[model samples]
Structures are given as C-alpha cells and as structure tokens.
Target: TQLLEQSPQFLSIQEGENLTVYCNSSSVFSSLQWYRQEPGEGPVLLVTVVTGGEVKKLKRLTFQFGDARKDSSLHITAAQPGDTGLYLCAGSESYGNKLVFGAGTILRVKS
Candidate 1:
C-alpha cells in the first residue's frame, strides 16, 4: 500500500516566521498533490508536481517532489496569520483514481 506521512502534526508560530513541512512515504507514486484547507472548508489545491525533483512556487509558498516520487516538501516564507490552516499531502496510487491523504499538518500563525 502507498501511504504518505507528514511531520509535525501541529505547528504554531508568530507572524513573519518561516517553516517547512515534509511528506514522506515508503512507496512510489505517480503524482503528488498539495492542498491547504481552512476551517469548515474544502481543501484548495496549492500545487501538483508530477515529475521527480519538480519544484513549484506560489506566492510565498514553495513545493518540491522527491526524486524517487516517494516524498514531497512544503516551505512557507514570511508566514502570515492568514496562512494558518490544515496542510495536506496526497499521493495517487498506481491503479486507483482516488488520492490517499496524509495525517495532515495543522499550522497556526498568530499575529
């Protein structure tokens, strides 16, 4: 089975701080998807990196896919209060159409 696990189940920091969240797995995946979800809302797609070693950036956020397609990372720069939310990493299995999500990393950025 392909499973993804994220580090630091919870993170709390003051505004303007920087942090990195990691997603690792023992099995390979065809693609990796990054999402951020706010309270009571569905997760919003942040980025989707398909190639190994691929990197994508959105605003103050950076995402990277592992060379073996078994891991990924998210880096946030100058975090703001609005950045506080649940961060999830999902990986698509070899045959399934559904994505298996990680335990999630809950982040809190206080002003």
Candidate 2:
C-alpha cells in the first residue's frame, strides 16, 4: 500500500464550480508538497506546507495541512476547464530518503 492515500480518486466538476481532494497518511512527515500535472508534461509543484494547521491560497485554490502533519487537502474554487489535470501529494518517509506519494487524484473540470 502506498504510504499516502488520497480520497475520491477521481473527480469531475463543471466549470465555475468548486471541489476538494484529500490526501491522508498514517505516518508523519517534516513537510508535504502538492503538484499538478497536465497531459504530456511533468508535474509542477503547487505548494509546500511545513507547519501544521497552515493554510495557503493561490488564485482560486486553497490548501490545508493537518495539525498532526499526517494529512492534507486541496480545495479549488470556481473551477475552470483549464484546471483539469492530475493532482498529487508527496512527502519523505521517516526512515529514509524515499519520497512516498499518494495514489493521485484525477480532476476533470468540464466546460
């Protein structure tokens, strides 16, 4: 099983809408990062939250870190067709340099 698991593996929302995807892990990390990938391209880092209970907002998106540092969530507001892509969460494991990733959440924003 992946060290991190994301809920609602897939999401389809209409444009101008809003949605949220969650990433959960039993293990704790010093920090966690979120990414978005479009077709035929590498994932671009969205944001990294290191402090527990920290929240960051970018444009119409919002991200929150769990108080325990074991989970995180991404919320998109007024979704746009161009926002359709794959969202992923990654973090370093406690034991080694291995970076564990969530299963990945696929988001489709329909126009």
Candidate 3:
C-alpha cells in the first residue's frame, strides 16, 4: 500500500475557479512529486520538490513542500477544462527511487 495521504478524493469546479489539494505523510522523503494524468495515458509529472519549504509554480498551478518534508500541497488558480484530470502525489525515501503514491484526486473543471 502507498504511504502518502491525499485529500479531496474528487473535486468539480467551474472555469476560473480556484482550488487547493493536499498530500501528507508521516514518513520523511528525499523528494516529492506531483502528477496529472488524463484518460488512457500515463501521468505527467507536474513538479518535484526536493528541499523542505520549497515552492514551484507552473502557470496557474502552485505547489509547495512542507518544511518537515512529510507533506505537500497543490493550488490551482483560474481552473480550466484542460486542467481536468487525476492528480497524484508521490514520495520516495532518500534516493531510494521507489515511489509511494497517494490514491489520487480526481478533478473536473467545467467551462
């Protein structure tokens, strides 16, 4: 079983809405990654945070890693239909490269 925790198993929002999701874990990791997956395809890594208290942004999406290295968060601004997908958070112990992923959060953005 995976070790990470993801909140909001499903979310639906109108275009232009802003939303946030979270991933939490009690175990410390060397790196944490966020991914977005579309139907019938593998997920695309959105960002990877290797340092505690790190933050990264891609267009309207913002990602943050907790200072304790055991949690992370993703925030989307001005949601669009193109942003609809399954969002997953994964973590790996220091350089182990064996990822443990959360159950995924399904987001549906309506225009």
Candidate 4:
C-alpha cells in the first residue's frame, strides 16, 4: 500500500454535523503531525503526537495516534462552514523535519 493513505478524499456535510478523517500507514513512525491547509496558504500545524496511544484535543477537534505510531485520526465534534479546509496527516521516521503526507481529506462544510 502507499506509505500513507486517506479515505474519502472528499467530504461534504451540513453545518452542525460531525465528521472524522483517517490516516493509515504500514510502517511505524516516531512522530505524526496533523495540519490544516487553506487555499493559497501554507499548512498550519494542528497537533503532533509522539508516543503511541496519545490523544490530544483542541477546541472542537480531537486527534489520536495509533499505538504503533503508524496511523492517526481527526474527529470534529461540530461542523461549520469555517471548518472547511484540507486536512493532511504526515508521518516522520525519527522526528526529522520531513513528512510524508496522506492523500488529504478535503472537507466542505455547507451552511
């Protein structure tokens, strides 16, 4: 399989809904980073999980890293038009400055 994979490349939902995006990998990673990117803008770091089975919450977003460090997920509690953007998950071998991004999940939250 591709080093990292994301499903449903696209997502659309009404406001006030919930959604989840996933990232999967076959190889283990030392650290995984999640970023949200908007059109014509660089991705902004949302969170990073170093240890396995780590969960971090930010506002309406919840991020989790798998026990093996090979996978991760992002869950949004309540959707909004402002939540529309591309969600990318990247994995690094040893906490290096490099990252391999997933296919990306394009979220479109309708009003």
Candidate 5:
C-alpha cells in the first residue's frame, strides 16, 4: 500500500499571512486532489491535478502537482481567519481507483 505524508501536521498563523503545505508519496498517482474540512462538516473538494507540473489557482489558494505525479502542494496567500481548517490530499493510482489519503494538515488562522 502507498502512503501520502503531509508535513507540519499543525499550523497556527495570523490572518493575512502566507503559508504552504505539502503532500508527498513514493508512488506515482494518476490524479491528485486537495480538500478542506471545517468543523462538523465533510471535506470540500478544492481542486484536482492530473497532469505532471500542473498548477491551479482558486482565489488566494494555489495548488500544484509535482513533475512525477508523486507529490503535491497547497499555498495560501494572505490567508484569512475563514481559512482555518483541515487540509487533506488524496491520490488515486488510476482512473476510478480508490484514493489514498494523507494524514492531513490542521491550520488555524487567527484574526
């Protein structure tokens, strides 16, 4: 079984700060997804990357897939208190395959 490792399991920062979180795996994936979860709610899909070196942006958030498809990163710029939540990364080995999830990163943005 493959595992995705997320770094800096916890983070606490002031509002308007910029931060980056990472997810990495030894195995390549056909696609990778990023999600955010708030208290008492299920994770909401943020973005997905299928191509190597692909980058996507949503508002102040940026998502990137590594060249080998074995890693991914999420960066938040000028983060706001609303951004406080759990960030998760999931990868699938093939189309329609089961997804392997990383442990997750917890972020707290204080106003």
Candidate 6:
C-alpha cells in the first residue's frame, strides 16, 4: 500500500499571490490525481498525471508529476479568493484500483 503525505496542512494567502502544494510518497504510483473540495460539496477533480515528469495546466493552475512518479505538486498562479478550499491528492497503484488519499491541505485565500 502506498501512503501519500501532503505538506503544509494549512495555508492562508492573499488574493493574487502564488503558492504551491505538494504530495509525496515512498512507494511509486501509476497515476496521481488532484482534487478541490468546497464547503458542503464533494471533491472536484482538477487533474491527473500518469506519466513521470508530466505537467498539466488548467487555466491558472498547474499540476506536475515528479520524475519518479512518487510525488506531485499543484501550483496556482495569481491565486484568487474563490480558490479557497481543501486540496487533496490521491494515488492509484494501478488501473481500476482504489485510490489512496492524502490528509489534504486547507487553503484560505483572502481578498
């Protein structure tokens, strides 16, 4: 079983600033996913990186998978207040397998 650990349990930043959150594990994973959850709502998928050293961009958000596939990071450029929420990272050992989730990072962006 792979155990994912996320850094910075909580983060508070001002709007328009930039920040990065990380996910790491000792065991390798086939794929890694990032999600965002708001109050009273389920986590919303942001991106998934399957290839090592791969990077995906969604608008102002950037997701990158480590060269070893054992780590990942989410970077937000010019963060906004609307981006405040819980960010979670999950790893899948293989296709069709259950994902192991990290403890999550709480992000609070103030305007």
Among all candidates shown, the one with the greatest lDDT: 6
**Per-residue lDDT over 1-111 for candidate 4, one digit per residue giving the tens place of the 0 to 100 score:** 238898779999999999999999999988889999999999999999998999999999999999988889999988989999999998986654778889899999999
What's model 1's overall lDDT? 0.96
Q: How well is each residue in 16-107 modelled by candidate 3, as lDDT tens digits?
A: 99999999998898899999999999999999999999999999999999999999999999999999999999998676568999999999
Clash count of each predicted structure:
0, 0, 0, 0, 0, 0
* TM-score of every prediction relative to native: 0.97, 0.93, 0.96, 0.94, 0.97, 0.97
lDDT by residue (1-111, candidate 2, tens digit) is 348999889999899988999999888887889999999999999999989999999999999999999999999999999999999999876566667788899999989
- Pull out the clashing pairs in model 6: none
Give lDDT per model, in order. 0.96, 0.90, 0.94, 0.91, 0.95, 0.96
**Any runs in candidate 4 off by more than 4 Å, and if so which?**
none
TM accuracy, model 5? 0.97
- Model 2: lDDT equals 0.90
Flag regions of model 3 displaced more than 4 Å.
Answer: none
**Predicted candidate 1 versus true structure: per-residue lDDT over 40-87, tens digit per residue:** 999999999999999999999999999999999999999999999999
* Model 6 global lDDT (CA atoms, 0 to 1): 0.96
In model 1, where is the ten-residue run with the lowest total lDDT?
91-100
Q: Is candidate 4 or candidate 6 better by lDDT?
A: 6
